[model samples]
Target: MLTLHPNSNQDVVDQSLPVNFQDFIKSEFHDMKQDLTSISKDITSLRQELQDIRIAMGFINDEHNKINEKIAKMESKFKAFDALVTTVEHLRTVNEKLEADCNAKDQWARRSNIEICGIPEKKGENLLRITEEIAKKAGFDLKMTEIDFVTRVSSTNKVNKPKPIVVRLQSRYRKDDFLACLRKLKVICQDLGFAKNESRIYFNDHLTKFNKMLLQRAKVLAKERTYKYVWVRNCTIMVRQNDTSPVIHIANVDDLKKIK
Candidate 1:
């Protein structure tokens, strides 16, 4: 057994303790450095992602502005189109009124004329002689010079029938008087030396092509509604339900609705 001093034992313990503490401090410092490096790398990645998000937001904002501009342009075009449509409709109404006025003037020009229907046509027949014969049968004192002209006109109907005689008198008053006499006499084809044909002759105011069509429509509608009178006066279509009923002037196809 060896004897040892207390001071020497204390000095040895102090030297070993210093070496252990130093090693522990070095290990903790190295671990701290590694943690700081990892935190720095993570911060750098987060910054890059934030920058990318900002760039994407800028692109989206630009697209939104472009869409707004396109919508504004479309709205303007639609407004312009609506205005154009209104203008066209107004023009159409004006054009229709002008055409109606022109037609009225044309019809008024033929006021002094008379249309004779149900008269049999013959080759080389004298129209003036036939007209004079009609006046004689009706007991009307009509002179040959009172007639300005007489001619056969083509029928507007599709059926193959005798052409009607159109007579333009020198005076409208004379034409009216002659028509009234013929109506009162109720002259027929047989009275005019057509012994085989007995169809009653018809005397009417000479109407334009348009007025003739309108008159036909008025006659059909009046008959359907049990109207007693449908006739043309001075090229104007007239309709009456009865003797006491108010007369209706039919100016166009739309007037047909007035019957009911």
Candidate 2:
């Protein structure tokens, strides 16, 4: 037999090794199995992320289209509402002016009127005579003709508390005299045989219906603001927080806001 001579080269040494290609392939199979498992997991995660992105992108596109459509619809309304808003604003302004003018007329009508409280109501009392008597007691001369109207405030039902009397005199001078004489309310109550508790009477200028409501609300606000007293003078409601505090005249609802 002829012996093969080995070439002294790197390739020759590699081929002369005891490890064969089949052994190498078998050793790599276990390592390749682990690598394939990791690769498969990576591919599954990538697919899932891609699917999530596709769904999110579709939702975002749909919402964006919806918003664009809504904006287009509202854009049309902007122009259409301009004229309507102007008309409404004009009507609101006119209404305020008319209301103010009407209130002025109402206040003027009540210029010579006076409101009296704590006057006990009698079943068949002569209200006119009682008013004249009250005027006389106040150190004033009042005739039956000088009085324009006299009546007690009406109520739906009879109440334990008497309804106040509203007396309308013919002249503003007579009304002033009536009010001035009311300052000596104590002496009048004593002469009239009224009890001490019943002596706490109130006399004030008759207020218009609107101002009456304003005064009621202002009184409540005054109490909340720690005012010592709320009283009316010359038909205007005034509030004092304490004895030394400056008087605050509440002419309307707007005046109440300054209290806070």
Candidate 3:
């Protein structure tokens, strides 16, 4: 049984109010602490995710740098390769020019010689006497002293033909005059006492192997194009459409384009 006055009741009510307020403060503090702990967990998870992203970015950057390095190396190699190709082309051009010069000099050395073809080869043939007989038939006064030497050379092809005779003359003028006279006469084997053979004797300027090949090419091209003439003079390859046309000189393989 509790007895209270009106002021005493007010004092009890005031004391109970403090206890309720303390309980309310404690509950709010607990809720706030839980919220702070949840926030800390969320921050830790974000930090780990950020660390993963940083690692990924670092790997990508390193790979990008490596790719750049490889690209730079490839560019350098390409430049060096281009330079090497240019040098090789220059050397090739120089070598071809030198070879042409050497071939020209070789042909110049053989200027005073004549090549005779289609003459039957006799086992005990006196080439000089044969030459003299041919000159006599052509009505040319070819003294024995004017001749330097005469020899039979093997044919360049595998065909079964007699070896040709190459005659060196002491004077290019004499050789030219003899060739002119022989061409005009159009002599044959029969003229040289080979009664059974009727093959025409052919006389020509002595040419280097290079010029000979060039002449053959020019002849074939001329025949294909219906050109009237392809002749060699002084080791030069000449082409003509006809007697009235201007002559074209062929100096190299590149000149084949001029045929058209």
Candidate 4:
């Protein structure tokens, strides 16, 4: 039988091989277990971050939608306001056009002569004083006929009558003051009971309908708007002309004072 030769090199190799093999298996398995645990933790953290990102994105989207709705509502309101502004501007233009047209057509009427009597105020006790002065200067009589006039007693103008007059009185004067003036005129007529006719007093709220001259005079006298005035008809002169003394002219409050 042939015997195998055992050298020193073979003996050392045999002893080291078993120990190195055991150490390699133990180290590899421990490293593999630690790597798996680290990978699991990383995956869990990534999932949590993804959930947080989705929640933040949803909030951002909701805010964007709310902002958009508010912008739309504001746009609608602005459109309505713009339409209203356009209508008002159109109406203003129309009003201005109409006023211009009226002014063009009524030029003569606007510039007509307006004579305000009882103006250029001369201070006096009553209307008779002014009428007498004007009559003396104008070469006319301050006398009135004892007959009824064509116009009513409350007629604002005695324009055609001789020495026509306008009167004004303080608005604060007592009701009794007006009554007293009328009573005085009536009493005068009673004294002249032999006369054919007498004077009459009339009252009306507005006098503009009967006479433009009277209205203008009233406006002139009402410089500070503190007084009121009116008109009256009367008989101041009793002259015989035709069969039963033709009526020459009518009288005013101022002229009637001298009737008796």
The local distance difference test score of each candidate is 0.83, 0.77, 0.85, 0.40
Best by TM-score: 3
Which rank order by TM-score, best down to worst?
Answer: 3, 1, 2, 4
Clashing pairs in 3: none
**Which 10-residue window in model 3 sums to the lowest lDDT?**
8-17
lDDT of 1 at 23: 61
Name model 1 segments beyond 4 Å from true. Answer: 1-77
Q: Is candidate 2 or candidate 3 better by lDDT?
A: 3
Between candidates 1 and 3, which one is better according to TM-score? 3
| Candidate 3 local lDDT, 72-159, one digit each (tens) | 9999999999999999999999999998898888888888888899998888899999999989988999999999999988779556
TM of each candidate vs. truth: 0.69, 0.62, 0.76, 0.35
Judging by lDDT against the true structure, name the best candidate. 3
Q: Give the per-residue lDDT of model 1 (tens digit) for 146-251.
A: 9999998888765656788988889988888888787777878888888988898888888878778888888888899999999876677889999999999998
Tens digits of lDDT, candidate 2, 28-146: 66578779888999999999999999999999999999999999989888867997899999999899778868987888788898888777777888888777777777767778898
Q: What lDDT score goes with residue 240 in model 1?
A: 95
Model 2, which residues run further than 4 Å from truth? 1-67, 78-94, 155-158, 187-200, 242-246
RMSD of 2: 8.1
What residue pairs are clashing in model 4? 144-237
